[model samples]
Target: MAVTTETAETGLVVRYSFLWPREHDRGEREGRKDRPVCLVVPVNVAPGAVVVFPITTQDPLPGRIAVAVPETERRRLKLPGDRPCWIMLDEANGDVMPGSFHLVPFETHPLRYAYGRFSPAFMRVVLRTMAEAIRARQLRMVQRER
Candidate 1:
């Protein structure tokens, strides 16, 4: 199901079809295709549109923008089997549906699919990391244009 007024708020975590590229060969290996993502963009900013960062349990790769999910926060959110998760900040994916944001459905306890929302503090850190990554990317782009 898509995101509604109740679930469109920032800091909400939802599962969606995320096309993650492989580390070695982006087009070859399949990364976490479907996973949870944190909504970073406020609902007011873009009512229907949303900006989200993908979450993964794999260790942060070199040169890839990512934010480590602290143990305390992970426990609070009840992530998958206490495994460490990281939020990728290099890019932001969106899920817009009929002039509204959409979020994939998920089950609790067993966590068959999507989990749920995350803590405000964790979202804050994610936003900060995203900002830094955007700046870095912009800088690199500017340099390339020179």
Candidate 2:
């Protein structure tokens, strides 16, 4: 099924071309690859915008903030449980739902599809962690074109 604005809720994991802050600063308009990203904000009706954090298997660099994905959660999302992954909370991408070019779809599907969604309990934890960063003014958001 296509990922409509209603389906693109907070905690939804979808494949997106997430342009990093550094990349945006360098004038690069596109991300290098399509990676799993967790939607961190609700899709607002006025602009149809949402915030997303990239999920990576690589370890966070020194002084960077990240949240480890639990093994149980990985299994639930059909991800490799043996490998470690984290949600990058120090930075995020802002994009519009329903019309974003960088939002990739599943191979078997023509429209945008979610890999899965994080449980509400886990999502709360993520939001709290992100809030800390936001309050500290440590989070950088890169707004992308729709």
How many collisions per candidate?
Answer: 4, 0
lDDT score at residue 9, model 2, on the 0-100 scale: 82
Which lDDT tens digits does candidate 2 get at residues 42-114?
5345556788899999999998888999888887887533688999999999888868788887787766467
- Residue 107 displacement (Å), model 2: 1.8
Q: Which candidate is the best by TM-score?
A: 2
What would you estimate as the lDDT of candidate 1?
0.59
TM-score of 1: 0.69
lDDT of candidate 1 over 1-146, digit per residue (tens): 34565556677666665544333234532224557777655446545456667778988768888888888877766666668889887755554533321244554333233355677777778777777887787211100000
Error of 1 at 101 (Å): 9.8
Once model 2 is optimally superposed onto the true structure by TM-score, how far is the C-alpha of residue 122 displaced, in angstroms? 0.5
Instruction: Provide TM-scores for the models.
Output: 0.69, 0.91
- Per-candidate Cα RMSD to the true structure, in Å, reads 6.7, 1.9
